[model samples]
Target: MKILICLSNVPDTTTKAKFVNDNTAFDTTGVQWIINPWDELALTRAIELKTDAANTIENITVITVGGKDAEPTMRKALAIGADDAVRIDVEPKDAYFVAAQIAEYLKSNPFDLIFSGIESADYNGSAVGGMVAEFLNAPSVSAVSGLNIEGGQVKITRDIDGGQEEVSVEMPAVLTVQKGIAKEPMIAAMRGIMMARKKPLNVVAPVEVEALTEIVNFEMPQPKPACKMIEPENVKELVDLLQNEAKVI
Candidate 1:
């Protein structure tokens, strides 16, 4: 079995987001790029499944849709433990474009299992996984919290309203994994880093696909109001503030 995991390069969570070009594009200056947190967990789970003693997986490849500037993030993914990497050379304009590009690649190279995070940290538009599945005409499971192979069958566990549901899926299926898929992300060890230096990172040209959406402008959220503190003795004032200002009471 082979696994393909999708990765998205995103700004570090601590970085203050800013936009430029008249607030039409993101400002990448002085920003630290990291793998999407959810995607990292999916990659971690893929590595764990591969390293198991009774593993049946043969290769684990990570793919991303980005420009040359995104290679560093892809390298980090390889260092953490993917067997190889594939880059679809294009700026990921939106969920639709990205899903289309990756699906185009899968036309020639197929994998038994494909893992996509529930959403990208930057966009949080949980749509790519299902789009890929639709494009490939393959079965998919969403909100997947658990995934494993038993008796050569793919089993998936998902959280429901009152309980969890488990089901077995056939191969060549897509799974959109959420938080509980892995405990922690796999850190790149020194030896893994050295080995990653030799791992192939193949770059593929993206096919022509008209972008379905366009960003008109970027807007920053309004600043939060300052906190007001009142003495514990001022019970009446606190109640008045809650009722009038905070609107809680």
Candidate 2:
């Protein structure tokens, strides 16, 4: 089985986000980038799955849509245990463009299983995995929290309204993994890091796809208001606040 995992390089969660180009583009100045947390989970889980299957999986290839600036993150994914990497040479415009680039890359090189995060941390669009499945005309499972492979079939558990649902499907399917699908991401060991330098990092030109959306502006949310304390005996006041001031009631 050949497995393909989609990854993204994103600003660390601790980084202070800023926008440039009249607030229409993210500013990368002085920002530290890392493999997106959700994508890391997907990669780690794919590694675990491959290992546990007694070498049923032949290779685990990680792919991304970005320029050379994103190569560091790709190497990090390789260090985490992917067999190889593919970097589509292009500026990642949006979720649609990214997914289209990946789908286009997969046209000639298909895999038995495809893994991606439900959404990227920076955009939180939650759209790419499903869009890639649509572009490839393949069955897709989203928000997957549990995965198991038996024989040639794949079973997945996902979150649903008020509960969870389990589904099984054949090979050549796409999955959008969620956080709990795997344990905390493993730190890349020194040996793995060294081995990653020798691993293949193939670069390919992106296939043509017109962008469907554009960012008009970016704005940070307003600072939250300070909390107000109410005395225990002021029940009526608390009720009034809930009914009028907070308006939650």
Candidate 3:
């Protein structure tokens, strides 16, 4: 099987977020970048599928849409077990443009399966994976929690209203994995790290696409209000306050 895993680089969870250019752009200075946590699940699962004895994966290719700064994150995916990496050298301005670039690349080379995270942490827009699937004319399942390959079909379990639903689709499909799909992806070990340095990483220019959205401005949310304290002895007063001021019975 030849699997393609779509990866993304994002700000580390601990990094402080700020805006620049009068709040028109994100302030990237002093920010540490890492692979998106949700993508890690898809990456790890792809590696597992490739290495499985029952259904061996012939190749696992990891691809990303970003500039040179994204190479390290792509290398990390290789160190974790992806066979090779490809980076579309471009600044991802919007999800639609990114999906278009990926779809254009995928048009030349077909893959048995494609994987991506349910949503990016920074944007929280869960649209790219499905858009890419649509562009490729492939079946797509989003926010999947479980996946298995059997009888040349991909079986996926996704969260529903209160439970989970399982669906099966044939090969040449796309899936966006949720958090609970697998355990946290492991970091690169010494041997894997050394091996990654020699792995193939191909860089290509991004395909052109007209952007559909533009960021007008950004502002931080207002600070939370201070807490209020009520004395235990003032039961009647509290009840009256709740009835009149608080408005909760």
Write down the lDDT of every candidate, Cα atoms only: 0.91, 0.90, 0.87
Candidate 1 TM-score, true structure as reference: 0.94
Ranking by lDDT: 1, 2, 3
Q: Which candidate, 1 or 3, has the higher lDDT?
A: 1
Is 1 or 2 the stronger prediction by lDDT? Answer: 1
lDDT of 2 by residue, 1-249 (tens): 899989989999899989999998889999999998988998888888888756488899999999999999999999989999999999988899999999988889999899998888798998888999999999999889998777767879999878899899776899999889998997899999999999999999888888889888999999988888889999899999999988999
User: Candidate 1, residue 92: CA error in Å?
Assistant: 1.3
Pairs that collide in candidate 1 are none
Model 3 stretches with alpha carbons more than 4 Å out = 229-249
Clashes per model (N, Cα, C within 3 A): 0, 0, 0
Q: Per-residue lDDT of 37-134 in model 1, one digit per residue for the tens?
A: 98899999999988875768899999999999889988999999999999999888889999999999998999988999998878889988899999
**Cα lDDT of model 3 by residue, 21-97, tens digit:** 99989899998888889888898887777676677678999999999999989989889988899999999989999
**Which consecutive 10 residues in model 1 have the weakest lDDT in total?**
151-160
CA shift at 175, candidate 3, in angstroms? 0.3
